[model samples]
Target: MLYRKKRYRINDYVFIGDNCHIGNNAFISSSVKIWNNKRIENNDKITQCNL
Candidate 1:
């Protein structure tokens, strides 16, 4: 997993798999599971699983 800056926010129960790239200003809500090889762009707001 690669995180750009400390400006990202990951809430409770957030599961991010391997090889994931969390960009700057990204927000991941609760109970959100991101699979492997996923790319979360800058300023992304993920409230749920997109897969």
Candidate 2:
């Protein structure tokens, strides 16, 4: 449970570069944006996720 990177609302001029890891109850919103550097592991276990 660790996420900071400026609240991750990067878009309109995206830029993400580093050893990133995004997982554990994941739901990246606001049009979804990604620039560089990648690592996303979401252990799915949802019965109802409507958003």
Candidate 3:
């Protein structure tokens, strides 16, 4: 059996690419541009992306 992961959108301007892992109860601020395969653990606040 293939393993399918669950996905979710942060907000209107925030973009979460494929394979992005956002832990439970994670807090992401506005305008955060997270690239592909990024893992954000719980209680994390993302405001911007350097890449």
- Whichever of 1 and 3 has more lDDT, that candidate is 1
Q: Cα RMSD (Å) per model?
A: 4.2, 12.0, 4.3
- Best-performing candidate as measured by lDDT: 1
Misplaced by over 4 Å in model 1 are: 1-4
lDDT of 3 by residue, 31-50 (tens): 77778888998766676753
lDDT scores of the candidates, listed in order: 0.87, 0.42, 0.69
Q: Clashes in each model (backbone N, CA, C under 3 Å)?
A: 0, 0, 0
Off by over 4 Å in 2: 1-20, 38-51
lDDT (tens digit, per residue) of candidate 2 on 1-51: 996543222223333346656666544543444435665447432222121
What global local distance difference test value does model 1 have? 0.87
Candidates ranked, most accurate by TM-score first: 1, 3, 2
- Candidate 1, run of 10 with poorest lDDT: 3-12
Q: Residues 1-51, candidate 1, lDDT per residue (tens digit)?
A: 995455899998888899999988999998899999999998999997553
Candidate 3, residue 1: lDDT: 94
